[model samples]
Target: MKRLLAMGCGLLVLGWANGMAAAPSPDTASVDKAIVHLAPTKGNKVQGTVRFETVKGGVKVTADLTGLTPGKHGFHVHEKGDCSAPDGSSAGGHFNPTGQAHGGPDATARHEGDLGNLVADASGAAHYERVDQQLTLQGPNSILGRSVVVHAKADDFKTQPSGASGDRVALGKIEPEK
Candidate 1:
């Protein structure tokens, strides 16, 4: 059985050397989807799920959240995956791999994790959707394992490092979809 397995492996490598298309390596294989389940931090009751799906030229981000104020709130992918802190400070700063000034998602230059805002309706529910070209599901720059944070206030979009968003009311880690 061992010899047969060796021969099969050898044959597969030989076929690839002969110009047969090889299967994509796991490291480079495309990830079709990712997800995050947000839980309220501290005393907040906000909870929701955010889905990321690959689309042409970018990833489509969709989020549905409840238990929020009836207005815009700051939202972003934070640097650290840890959400242990009661105030959500364990997640650290924004996921600014490219080292950019804080800006709206549509800005010419912004943090890779800067996802702008999520507006809650009068009923304390918010639904958001957008195509983010800067986000990646694979590669070193991928947002996987990082954390998403929902702040208590709107992102002013002109702050220095992080928008003047208030407390982190909710947090979740980005993970590959099952």
Candidate 2:
């Protein structure tokens, strides 16, 4: 009976440990889709990794960009997550969370898809970290089904919200990992 009791206690501890590790973080959830890949654009020079994290608040994007012009550049979550096309035209317009027109990410009245500029270093590298309270990784308005884009120009932050990045230099799609 003593040995049996010990074994049962060990099993319970093991189960509890497993449950803790498998449990999602308080402000985060199991990210259904996360794909970080590379692509070339016709305009700006960009190369880096993009990660999509599903948090309790919403979906988060962490971008590490290099080979840029060392300054402010347009960064936005596009409507489509398809970067299959060479020119990256496959990625649709900016993400519109409120179903509004395309605007800056910080714009008071703009699309939920708009995200502000990404600042690069003298070496032309930029690191972006953003958590969207309105986007998701699995819902209809989910950014997981969208694309992350880097532009060659800086978003004035006032001009219609989307700093009018001349063209798409780099692109990546957000998809769930297996």
Candidate 3:
């Protein structure tokens, strides 16, 4: 009887260990869509909405912004979700989980947040659409809790750690679609 009880206990322990090991890791199953509603920073009038949807190749990002200059502006997914500061400094630097250099979205070596630039039209409005392969809504590199920031100047793309983008003009936090 004693030997049988010991064997049963060992089997239970092995089963529990196996179950733990087989548990699934973090994924995007619950995050099919996300959105960020941008607001103007200090002394800026930029406002917009950015939507992220899971597509076949990657996340499809769509943005519509107004009140910007008729030119290109730097855009990125910042590391922090705080946009409380008037200057949008509350949102930290770009979200670079892989510690890559600052480059355009198509570059082979670039930060996951290096989304390049947004071009405003003559009416001070901009519409952007792209399929990003590096960004993810789920997993360890997820951008769900991060923030989006628009800069006053265009991203130079050649800068070392970050493109010499100017001051942040707009800020928003990424959240699951309601």
Question: Which one wins on lDDT?
Answer: 3
Q: Candidate 2 — which pairs collide?
A: 27-56, 33-175, 33-176, 34-175, 81-146, 95-113, 97-112, 104-161, 155-163
Query: After superposition, which runs of candidate 3 have C-alpha atoms over 4 Å from their true positions?
Result: 1-28
User: What is the TM-score of candidate 1?
Assistant: 0.83
| Ranking 2 against 3 by lDDT, winner | 3
What value does the lDDT take at residue 26 in candidate 1? 30
Q: What RMSD does each model have against the real structure? A: 9.3, 12.9, 7.3
- Among all windows of ten consecutive residues in candidate 1, which has the lowest summed lDDT? 19-28
TM-score of 2: 0.72
TM-scores for all predictions: 0.83, 0.72, 0.84
lDDT of 3 by residue, 1-178 (tens): 9999999999999998864432223344588799999999989999999999999999999999999999999999998888999999999899888888899999988988999999999999999999998888877678887899999999999887779989999999998897
- Candidate 2 lDDT over residue span 1-178, tens digit each: 9999999999999998865543223222455547667577765567898787677676677888888887898887776777877788898777765667556665567766677788999998888887766656654355655678878888766665465786778988766666
Off by over 4 Å in 1: 1-28
Residue 90's C-alpha lDDT in candidate 2? 90
Q: What is the lDDT of residue 15 in candidate 3?
A: 94
